[model samples]
Target: MTCLKADLLILAGVICLSLVQRGKTKTPARVMALVMTVLMVAVAFIAVPISSMNTLTAAQDITAKLNPNKLDAEIEKIAEIKPVLLFSPKCPACKEVTEALAKLDPKGEKWQPVQSSGEAQEGVKYLKEKGYAGEVSYHRYAGGVPVLIIKQNGKITTIYGKENIIKAVTAPAK
Candidate 1:
């Protein structure tokens, strides 16, 4: 039933086995049993959410920095020219793309960041404080972070991600 109770039961069983085997007077069996029990407990913890707390915390930190309202306007602006958008967060590859776009005539103004999670009010507040005025759309991608879509006329055209996002965003009209 409960995890603590289960762990205690398992630990008790291991201790009992260790003691019973020790009654005959051997040392190797006792050591092996202790090691096995420790390993089992370790595996149990690794297979659970406790091990993933760091990753979840990092994701939340990243999500906290996004301005959703600005994202909405960036999407609208991009849609006026193209139809799809490729985007990624503040990773090195995405930064490379941003740098490449910066070299273009009009740069950072065309891109937007979409936070994949967190409270909508916080996101809106962030955008307002940043003075970002745009039509924002809050939606998740199929299996990744939220992607901003820019539609030209009625067709989807630009997509943004960690890789090649700059090239996709800055390419000539097609």
Candidate 2:
């Protein structure tokens, strides 16, 4: 599944690039081409290719190899005001977390919703379609879906799983 998705993304990139080369220089098309190019680059950087059947260990390896300083800087830049909730609509666990969070933040004001997936392509589409101005940190923390990144006291806490996400968000702040 992961390979298929990646291949599809690459095909999309090729199509966009061909459009750009064939004089489809309108702003939206060019912008999409650029975005697709960047996403392809990010896909290349993914530490491990996580397939649907073998995601657990690969995601853990990616999580373990995460650079804290780079991640901290990204969190401060992207989620400085609202914590970033990285999720995938296709994931059952992510759906549960989103449902639980909706109860806490009825107006969706507590956290910034950023789409995530085993591949890096989903977040870019989510940001563009949602008109979100934040950056895609999915490639930075690809430890499965429903990952909530909270920055408190200048520290970054990456919480995974539906239950842990609920508990962390509902917990009393220090």
Candidate 3:
């Protein structure tokens, strides 16, 4: 995406410069054009890549979220027996978990994120990408949400599918 943006910027600069060179007469106009062109070039080279990376990292959290060990270590911070739902607003199956969670924790006591509000979606996508979503006996999940996890006694249990999710959420934490 950054490369595309930079190529577009370069193409635009070439077209605009051609027009300016053909039409302009004054040295002052030429100098101003040079200044503007330099600024634009700088922006294309420096700002575009940085912004693109920031956008991807912030939206997907892909690189940082792929490690299951890291994910487990973080989940260990929450209560001994609480439901952690990996949800993305876009996922259809996540809706059921959300509803179940609402009932399971009326005061929102038993549920939390893999990390936070939007990061869980990114984590779920990471899990799907690596084929870790449904490889285990307990997890029959395959590239879908919500992935309901319960951390109890330093153990992480992963659950998938609507039926499993209903059971995971409603089951009392031991």
- Most accurate candidate by TM-score: 2
Q: How displaced is residue 8 in candidate 2, in Å? A: 23
Error of 3 at 21 (Å): 44
For each candidate, the alpha-carbon lDDT, in order, equals 0.48, 0.64, 0.51
The alpha-carbon RMSD values of the candidates against the true structure, listed in the order shown, are 13.1, 11.9, 13.3
> To one decimal, what is the Cα RMSD in angstroms of model 2 from the true structure?
11.9
Model 1 agreement with the true structure over 1-174: per-residue lDDT tens digits: 135457768777877777777454457667866886887678666444353456444433344354322334554664675433333333334334434443542324565544334554544454444444543334443322423356655654434353445555556766
Q: Which ten residues in a row have the lowest lDDT in candidate 2?
A: 126-135
Native-referenced Cα lDDT, model 1: 0.48
Q: What does candidate 3's lDDT look like per residue over 1-174, in tens digits?
A: 345566667667765765566444555555766676777678666543445455433333432344323444444454254676666544545655555555555445555534233434454454444333321112222222456667655676666666776776667655
In angstroms, the error of model 1 at 124 is 3.3
- Predicted structure 1, TM vs. truth: 0.32
TM-scores for all candidates: the values are: 0.32, 0.47, 0.40
Give the candidate order by descending TM-score: 2, 3, 1
